[model samples]
Target chain A: MSDLKKLGVEVLSMSVDSIYTHKIWQEEELSKMVEGGFPFPMLSDAGGKVGQVYGVYDEDAGVENRGRFIIDPDGVIQAIEILTPSVGRNDAELFRQVQAFQLVRASKGKEATPAAWQPGEPTLKPGPDLVGKVWQVWKPK
Target chain B: MGEEELDLGCARPTGGPVGVQPDQVPPEREGKSIEEVRKPMVSVGKKAPDFEAPAFYEGKFKKIKLSDYLGKWVVLYFYIRDFTFV
Candidate 1:
């Protein structure tokens, strides 16, 4: 969250925990994080209304799944990643995506980030530049 | 050579009109600028998905809705676990 703050990215975290549980956790855990200095608003979605809209609610699991959606400033869904319960969200990858989105926005849609691509990294041009450039950057074992 | 052959010399690649650079046009003057066309995942364009429910904000039960941030950018992120080290 701080990394995103450094990049000027605003973030809101929502959870499926009930208000009672959220309050308890906030007082017990979040207060410590704050003293330790974790800065960001934690939202509660106890009814799972938000999760339903994003398709992250797991009825069987009785909790929201790990889902991340990068919405552009225009309100359009740019990127959506929903991970299974067993998996975890990658903060580094999310940071890279945020950077890539910023680059795409800065370029005014002339370019897009390729797979596993990072900011300031070479991007493909969707035609002749696709194969050669992609191969050059492809990490081989 | 035929007139067609003569015209071929002036033709640009992609068989479109020559001497017109699309980027040369001012973004605003163009019908759809890249900024105007590309929509962000969360804000400024489409109405954000409405979410109205009970939430503890500041103090007390408050109604939090997507409409609350009609004009502002809102990033709603969700995680499966809390207080767990990955």
Candidate 2:
């Protein structure tokens, strides 16, 4: 999160735990991170109200699922990925996704990214020169 | 793997190409596209939910509301537990 802040990305993390447990955990885990310099806000959802609204609440497991939603500056959800309880999300992939979104937004609908694509790669425009032009510029090793 | 009777909603034999018969199509997939396989947990374009709850700021209890940050972009995330490794 601190690294992302340095890159000019604001992050807010929320939790669906009680205030007492939240406080204890913050003292045990987050205090060390803060001492080591972590710049971000952590919100508390004591009663699972926020989690219920987000639809990530799991009553059986008594916790929110691992979900990642990338909202644009206009508050529109551009991309979302929800993982099962047993799986964890990848931070490097998230960075790439952010880069991809930034590139697409910067292009202003002139270009579109292909599957499994990354930033600075060749983008294809939907026109007569679509596949042919893309293939010409795309050098897959 | 038995020859007694095989009813898999297919007309072809056991070793034939696997293809769905006209009547074998599940009712759920009758008129849906691949994009409609799963619905989003939350509506993307709708207004965000508002909440008035106790939040900690600067080591003190503070009241925060979703409406307070209406004009700006807010990323509201939810984790199962506060201190668990995510």
Candidate 3:
């Protein structure tokens, strides 16, 4: 959460549960799991209206499946991921994507991050000369 | 020419054109299968759908709108339910 905040990103979590349920769950379960409870807002997506738009709502189960969206400052979605209840999200991967997107946006699409790119790693400059030469600059172990 | 020798040129992959406006209801919503309706309305290059919902924040219940955070990056996530492992 702190890392996201450092990048000037705001996180909002949502589910079909009511606010009352959120209160109890936070006080009892989440607080113990994370110090001071969750740092972001917990939205009560009653009736799954919001979930329906995001395409995570499960009508038969009356619940929303796990989904995540990364929206840029322009209110455009940069990425989307949907997962089932049996799986958990990888926070590190999510953070890495956020960083990559930020770099791309800052560079105005001039730079493209390679796979498993870290902050200081070299980024690709898309051009005709670099087409087949990517192998020379970036060697995947 | 062999498959590797054939130059297709560098062209962006094209997706089906969006026939329905974001805010408008599709004319043939009923004809769409469950999978189609469940497809995410927003895409990477498209604007995210704006919404307002009740939220619990800092011990207070308040209404929050997606537009409120327009000037900052947002990481919106949905979980199956509360009190479950994330």
Best by lDDT: 3
**Residues A1-141 of candidate 1: C-alpha lDDT, one tens digit per residue:** 777877776565677765445556666787686663345445667645466556777767767777777766665666777777777777898889888887877778777777778777776555565656666755533
**What DockQ, between 0 and 1, does each candidate earn?**
0.13, 0.14, 0.33
Give per-residue CA lDDT, model 1, range B1-86, as digits (tens): 00111112342211111122447656655786543322222323344455444444433333454444433334567777566544
Candidate that would win on DockQ: 3
Q: Estimate each model's TM-score.
A: 0.63, 0.66, 0.83
- In model 2, the runs with Cα more than 4 Å from the true position are A33-38, A139-141, B1-53, B63-75
Ranking by DockQ: 3, 2, 1
True C-alpha contacts between chains kept, each model in order: 0.32, 0.35, 0.82
Q: Tens digit of lDDT per residue, candidate 2, span B9-59?
A: 333211211122345556877786432322233566565545554444444
Runs in model 1 deviating more than 4 A are A33-38, A125-141, B1-48, B53-64, B67-74, B81-86
Greater lDDT among 2 and 3 belongs to 3
Error of 3 at A19 (Å): 1.1
Docking model 2 quality class:
incorrect
Per-candidate RMSD, Å: 19.9, 17.5, 14.0
